[model samples]
Target: MATYDLKGKRALITGGASGIGLGAVQAFLRCGASVAVNDLADDRLTAVVDELASAGHAVVAAPGDVGNPEQAPAMVAQAIAALGGLDYLVNNAGTPGTARPIATDDFERQDEDFWQLLVNVNLVGPHRCTRAAAEALRATGGAIVNTTSIAAFRGGGSSAVYCATKAGLVSLTREWARALAPQVRVNAIAPGLVDSDWMCRFDGQDDAVRMGQPVPLGRTGTPTDYGEAILFLAAGAAYVTGQTLNVDGGLTT
Candidate 1:
């Protein structure tokens, strides 16, 4: 719930239609930033934009499937156009590629197609969005905050492929920080068990209650928790980059 004096700042958040993405959008708006939210082109996108706009927020829609290479560039371009320029890009779009966790021993379930889908959406998608937005980000001396996961380090995600893709993203965050240095900053967030639709897929309401008991914080994460971390990385962490902030309520510890 922290606020910043970001009246003129502009941001584009991929997967901004819901969950952490939506939370970031609201946080940026609360701090007086004009935000462009990106999600797969669908009715949900329209609904979210409308809902936020109705609430008097400076929000615009920039819809496209980040997983589609052919569509990623256009998505970033449209977002930049909508915002006039980009100051921050939150690469938050990702997928688990399954309805539930797939155990490592279930070799048959870890098929090539599952691997391909997860890689395309969770790994390559961020690269595509970042590449497309690099010039504008450099122009504005902006920052990039990628949405990684605790799975990257703990290897306890829905699938091995899911963990691998997040791990790849962590590597990319460092490399991109180096590549985009002296102009733009790049960092990442590794969330633990967030109470979002995505997490519900792995742990339903009942299980989530039981899961929270083990966390040091005694509760699951919320979208606002992630949004605040992202806002810090984007608008306040002037001297920070190439690092992954674990907003996991000490679960990883």
Candidate 2:
């Protein structure tokens, strides 16, 4: 794992209670950054904060629904206030809205309400947080790293709606990079085959083996696999912006 001297830095991670978000949380905290873990108001959110706090890490719970327009910016503001200021924002909050992958032609499942929900959290949610945090980040010369997905680059993911939102995020990453340039850096990561809680399953006896067989690396990826990448983009990679790093284990190759 990559390491950095983040003793006085502060960060905010949305959808941070589990999976890649949790991975980033542990990475930032391990490197000495104070973090505000954002998620929906629920027991899982409280449990994560309590666990991290008990471990002596500087973590506070910033619970709200990223899918809710009013709650999104409000949560970012609260997180910034609690952490004193923000040096980094990881827009990792998103949902596939379904456990199973929806076919490209499944327009019924990809209805108006479904698209709106995905767009709200996966696309518009980051915009809300970035808009709220732009000034703070600019003051500190900080950066924003969005948790996009390999779905944005390829034909497979949870659903067409999910892919559309993630792809839109990639466009936003570049646009925001230009908009926030010379001040706050903007970038993204497109993870592939990560064995996170977001929903990857197989009925095979060895799901990991079954799922990872097609990848050149021959294994599924874990949260830690992405945590390292997040660490680099957040605290290192000073000159890199507007790019989406593929953190897959050679899956796309």
Candidate 3:
């Protein structure tokens, strides 16, 4: 894992109970930063918090559903409070909007409710969290890293709605970077075929293995790969903003 001089900084990572979000939390902690983790309120969230705390990492639980507009701001505020302030915000929470991939021709499956869910969670959710954290971030000249996906550019994801939402996030990242200029730097990471619990729901272990065969890296990405890129945006990429770093191991190249 890569290291950085993140000591004394404070961060909040949404959907941080596992996968890339949890990996970000661990990365920040390893670099001596205090991190507040946000996820849906549940036993899993509690377990993650306890486990990290037991290992002597500076982590706190800020649980709420980002899909809920009302809950999003509250969750951000709670995380900011827990961390005393916020220097970095990782908007990693999102959903595929289905248990299985919905092909582009599956128009019947793309109902109003499905579109609403994907938009609310993947698009509006990040906006809500960023808006809520803007003031705190401005105060500290902080940074924001959004988790988009290769689907944003390459297309073909778990659902058409999922791809659309991530593409919207790419646009939002550029716009937000402009909006928060000179104080809070905003950027995004586009991950590809990450091996995680979330992706496993759509692509089984065997599927992931097969998918990795043609990649330049000869393997699927890991949460730590994303974590390192996220940390770079937050702590090391001083002149970088409004850009989408494709952490796909040359898959997009």
Candidate 4:
């Protein structure tokens, strides 16, 4: 058996109905892991699970708003129950708030509601979910892979709050790695300008051409791009922890 073998391992992914999260779910299933997906859209969740089941993979649907404090724990519990035990946790749920240049005073003036929503979903939500699953993760000696973004480092992706929240997640990854050493590993991936619905919303482009222009790679990243990096961090990077892998196709450069 391969040392990176995920066969029979159980994994949980937040925001797994679409985009990078869905890509991660597919990758994990391909590696023989039973996957549990959590997302906000009920119909999308049901449809995704149905597709996976038809493909002969075990999948659990756990739909809810991860940003809600109570809901994160409930989803974790549901996944644990369905999978029998947890071996991996992918904190992939995130949202870009109103995108604007940092120099604009309007961007700086983030009202309480805007700040709260961005921070809760991008940062605190993962914190809550990981905390809830810590025991199960430790018991299985599993790993956690968070989906952070280059905005965390370079700034100016979406709203100011969104950048701050992603930066905070990088901090959380290191914090958890240190605190949970030897029992569970914690890491994150900071992608730069991935091609997703969020990008479509941000750029008003229905296709990849407009989205890929600015990047040095001459293209925006696909979900499969980050998906591959994430699975490597989870299954193959056993000696790795407290690290943030950049899957941005050198966009930051």
Candidate 5:
């Protein structure tokens, strides 16, 4: 239905050069949205921007480290300028955090730096982006769809920090939803195990095996699965906010 149509809407998606973020970018474009894609990788950003621009899509690359407190605001400003305004934001950046259980003595024996790195990237990163984008979203009556993970609801992912930060994101979604109020809608998606190159970072010996060992789904999810749900939250879920939709193939249940 046209209720879900996002034609002419402007979107800012973090980590849009690859993985789940890139998948959301494609779906948004198909729904007729102008997009500004953000990522830390300059080359990947350029390539994605060029490809989409060539196809006559209003897409631009906003290259900056989201984990950098200063860079987040700058990236948001650039997205506003490039896309003319912002209507939707997909906060999809994430870090699996070296792919190890935090309970392991080896992981705990590492150092504080490891934990801080995870917090900065997995937690503060999205906070910075959302803070920077909040004003723009409010002005346009926009929506913010944060990409969390099933790790937020379950304890079986990367490490203590990753899961904790994702859970924090879920809390942020609920708080921002009420704070932004009848203006900018804030929500989140907590996806199950997604089959992407990012998964390669976990259990390097065999990514396939690790992914397949997940819940009733019998297999891992695809980026598109999460991407479509993102689109729904951004455009279709008009009456929804302060909720974290779990796209985990019924994993949590």
Candidate 6:
């Protein structure tokens, strides 16, 4: 946990209600940056923002569904306005569309709706947010950090569609770096198995003990692990862009 002098800085993190996104929200606040937390309009969003505000951290609730074409840009605009400007945009919203992993050969299960849902949230959603926040980011010379997945690189994921969408995001990250250069830098992180409460759950399997066994580090990653990397890319990493860092506890190695 390196300390960054993020005082007076402002950031908006999508999917900020829980898991890695929540971790990122805390990271930014700890470094003295005002944050606008975005998620679907839900009770968790209210509670998280209220809790941070009560703690005297400058936090705002900017709730909306990134999958929605209209709400995504509107939410980013409103968040940027609320923050007075933006220094960082973390495009962390995404979905696996399943409580358990769908077998790769389960073609019948990998239907049209499943593919579309993954694409909408995991791929197009980031594009929507980045595009909406581009001008503000450019003005401030801010950076964008996208939450991709180790699933983008290899075979193990909830489904084929989920992996494909994340891979698409990797491509977008590179293009966005070029599109916003000399003003804003863009990068991504591909997380390995993480011990977080999200839509993707392993029934009767302990993520730390089961999934951790395969990781070279012999542990599943916590939100803090990925969060630290997110913070670095957003506030630091001046010379880094058009890249995807593997925050996977050496799993990729």
Off by over 4 Å in 2: 200-205
lDDT of 4 by residue, 1-253 (tens): 2235688899999999999999899889888999999999578899999999998998989887889988889989999999999999999998765652333235747789988898889988998899999999999999999999888898875677778898999999999999999999999999887777767764366554575777888888888888878899999898999999988878788
Task: After superposing candidate 5 on the true structure, give the runs of residues whose Cα lies further than 4 Å from its correct spot.
Answer: 1-3, 99-107, 203-206
Per-residue CA lDDT of model 6 for 71-182, tens digit only, reads 9999999999999999999999998888666665565778898899989999999999999999999999999999999988986656888888999999999999999998
Task: Tell me the spans in candidate 1 whose CA falls farther than 4 Å from its real position.
Answer: none
Model 1 Cα lDDT, one tens digit per residue, 1-253: 7779988889999999999898888889999999999998899999999999999989999989999998999989998998899999999999888767666556676889989999999999999999999999999999999999988998864688888999999999999999999899999999888887756665578776667778999998889999999999999899999999999999989
What TM-scores do the predictions have?
A: 0.97, 0.96, 0.97, 0.93, 0.91, 0.97
lDDT at position 138, candidate 6? 98
Supply candidate 2's per-residue lDDT for 207: 63
Cα lDDT, model 1, residue 247 = 92
What's the count of clashing pairs in each model shown? Answer: 0, 0, 0, 0, 0, 0
lDDT tens digits, residue span 1-253, model 5: 2335677799999999888899899889888899999998678889999999999988888888888888888989999988888999998877766654444334565478877887888788888888888888888999999998888887665667677788999998999898999998989999887777757656563774565665677767777888888999999988999999998877787
lDDT of each: 0.91, 0.89, 0.91, 0.86, 0.83, 0.91
For 1-253, candidate 3 gives per-residue lDDT tens digits of 6678788899999999988898888889999999999999999999999999999988899999999989999999998988899999999999888776567557687999999999999999999999999999999999999999999997875677888999999999999999999998999999987888656655578887777777898998898889988998989999999999999888898
Which regions in candidate 6 have their CA more than 4 angstroms from the true location? Answer: 205-208
lDDT: which is higher, 2 or 5? Answer: 2
